[model samples]
Target: MSLPTKTRQWILASHPTGLPTYGTRTDTFALETHDLPALSANQILVQTLYLSNDPAQRGWISPPSQIDPKRLYVPPVQLGHAMRARGLGRVLASQNGNFAAGDLVQATLNWVEYAVLDAGDPAAGVRKASELPGGLSVTHYLGALGGTGLTAWYGLVEVVGCRSGERVVVSGAAGATGSMVVQIAKGVVGASYVVGIAGSEEKCRWVESLGADKCLNYKSATFEADLKEACGDGVDVYFDNVGGQILDHMLANMKQHGRIAACGAITSYNGEAVLPMKNYFDVVSMRLQIKGFIVLDFMAKAAETVGKLVGAVQEGKIRVGEENETVVQTAFEEIPGTWLRLFEGGNQGKLVTKL
Candidate 1:
């Protein structure tokens, strides 16, 4: 096999002040052709196949001074470096013992078509995608059977400890992780009433199809009243994905000792300060328990969790990419725009780019 001596990459040209925009003259990201370096011992070369566009990408590219000191997962993508991203790829060649040519892997492939990764680097999160259970499309590894699905499972099952016949509410209910929460809360866990909050009526309908009893459009003028009506009794569990006014509403409507799983805050992902909980007193008064978690926190149980998720999907208790995903089959240059769609509410569910 002949390998190219050079590779095209999307480098972080400058820190983004807000949602990143890519164009002919943008500093957020700049495409450059660079010479590929020879792989050292225990290094593997991979050809990127698909990329995941997540809300977390925004936080990963913010100005270093702006990011919260406590929330630093890893150092922000440094200037002039390839923009960090999660992707699925195929091993093109390898000097590593664990991997070989043609092995499908999931890792932090960044915004490049070709990547050279060290086999021993745990930060790369290298795993064999081909080893996942059969009968599922390759994209499901990035959606239902991947980190997205695992986050939903961990938040709902472990953090919130949701139970049968409970009243559950999910914000961003039509999104990737949120949609899965709806399925598990209602269909799998047997929640008696599941209310979903989405951006539009179309999304609301889709959320209902995913087993929500009622899906409210937060953009509506009567959204507050609608939320009050949706929560006839106080909510027992809340799966919160957006943390702004909607969170305040959920806080106000929570039952005494209600549990909340703070999964992601898309409302503030794009260079905005997280909105303060005006109804914070509700937390004290009602004794509401809210815990925030990231998917990495549950790495030890990844395989077990993924097994359950696959079981649910196989039994048709949960729907995956075909019903709840939007794929962009475009070139690498369009990746930033695909990521931008999350903040803009331009996508229905998990957004992935097939390169």
Candidate 2:
């Protein structure tokens, strides 16, 4: 018996404005469903169950030559190309003896319902779908247990090298990656003090619930003073997700020899004008060690990191949360607009599109 094939996909139609807009540059591609082609010796076919929507995906669509030199992380998505995404799926057919049909897997598939992948393909890096441990959700594999989780872990543990009894500050504290950074710094490293900055009072409270010793709303009039007061002991490790002004303020408060992990700069993602840092002299005076990295650079340790995180979650040592929104059938056309919502501070957690 052969399985039927037909699929709908999202494709890039044109470059986006400062923010993605509806009816501007996104289109749906209806692909003819054909019989599952015989896979090569190392190929597998998967049916996507969940599609991940990440900030980095936005950067991927920007013209390669036009993106800021510092922000180039992955190859640009060519116009008319299938939008790239990471997804959780179950194998429906396999040519590789290592993976059998019905095996749950995760891979970087296009934003479509089904994908044909080659296990030996360097880009795919297919792995068995992680089993959800007690009190953990499968979706977490795409968020806390997956890429976002790894981003937080590597930035703190590897880049920032957070130490016990150190004072730490994290920007974008209410976000999926930032939330995990707070918990990992406080619960895992047992930091002496942990401060979080977010965009809303409700998000500030949410950050506090995750063990941040202090939480401040970046949108508040007194945000800078409040942040300074919260970290009076001095910041030893600054995990920055939103750069620009928040980074400038935090740099002013860093103690000598402090380390900063420069993560995503969502603050500048939507801006038409670049914000200049007038206080870079702080890096020189404080002898700060500032490092920037992408999560893909740490893929070699993903399995080990996932194991540790799973252990932490199972022992009640660390808490995890997720914010998700469903893209309605008609709303498929609204993806570009929906993507822009992230830059406007409209999303609370990991955003995903369900097919």
Candidate 3:
């Protein structure tokens, strides 16, 4: 019946020199309390519930990608400003006709408990939570039924155009988006041989559990040899999620006319030295088509894409942490620390926290 006057938020305290540490580091994030402001004519107030912590947040503080920074499509968040995320929340107040109080919605709300959204901005979109179709949890807004699935659907199906019998390889295959790509490639797109590349044996097993023909740990001593052996007929479509070295390896071993969906490049999001790849010209020799895309580019297809994924999940056709039980959950207060787990390969499937 009554709304709080103050809200807690995580703001940019200082720029991170490298990987930001939660709860301890100075340059990571700082939680600050702010008084709620009155809504404008076209704004709505939201009470954030589940927040999605993604690798893209690394690009927020880290420098632009040295290869081609624009693909990240990261909007700028100035210091002392609250961190923004796509959150499954409820509208507590509204000044716009688009949303009403008590409507469950997903928006570019802040990591804070509450935030204001301008539904008209294409980027600052707010979708009704009840509208998203599939789920074992509300965290689906952060994974398969949200931007993650949208990215995988458009990239694998449209960008790579994977065929039924094609040999597909997915790098960064353990992340939220990467994991979805692997499943969609096999279960939905009908790829014949699917290989996943991640950092650890556990991640590899999770990939295998998702019906991947094989999974390779990129950090292994024989990683290069493993990848080479996995691609018996060479990679037909490579869903590149972690770029840089992994991409170079895939490029060097691709089949002729192979397609690549250039998704996120978390490898270079650390603002560190970038490794050089001499094999990029393989694009010319192999006649490869490497296209970089941001999921936001395919927003128009969100409903249809999410609907398909939801149906697949419900029918037991796709595995997205629900069918196989791989979700990792934590408390709302641990949001900052929980994000660090992704970079370290410490998280299992979709790492999310309850509000």
As for candidate 1, its clashing pairs are none
* TM-score preference between candidates 1 and 3, better one: 1
TM-score of 2: 0.89
Candidate 1, which ten residues in sequence have the lowest lDDT sum? 130-139
**Ranking 1 against 2 by TM-score, winner:** 1
Shift in Å, residue 145, candidate 1: 0.9
**How much is 50 displaced in model 1, in angstroms?**
0.4
Query: How far off is residue 150 in model 1, in Å?
Result: 0.5
List the candidate 1 regions with Cα displacement exceeding 4 Å.
24-26, 131-134, 273-276
lDDT of each: 0.87, 0.78, 0.79
RMSD of each: 1.7, 3.0, 2.7
Across 1-355, the per-residue lDDT of candidate 2 in tens digits comes to: 5653655556776666466543434432222223445567899988877767677777776654558635576777777767788877889888988899989888887766678899778799688875687645577778888999899999999888899999999998878789899999999988989999999998888889889988999889988889888888578999999888889888899999999999988766644565788778999999999999999899988889999998898777688644422232324444445555567676665665554
Task: Give the winner by lDDT.
Answer: 1
* lDDT (10s digit) by residue, model 1, range 221-264: 99999999899779999999988889998999999999999988
Cα deviation of 193 in candidate 3 (Å)? 0.8
Residue 327, candidate 3: Cα error in Å is 5.9
Q: Which has the better lDDT: candidate 2, or candidate 3? A: 3
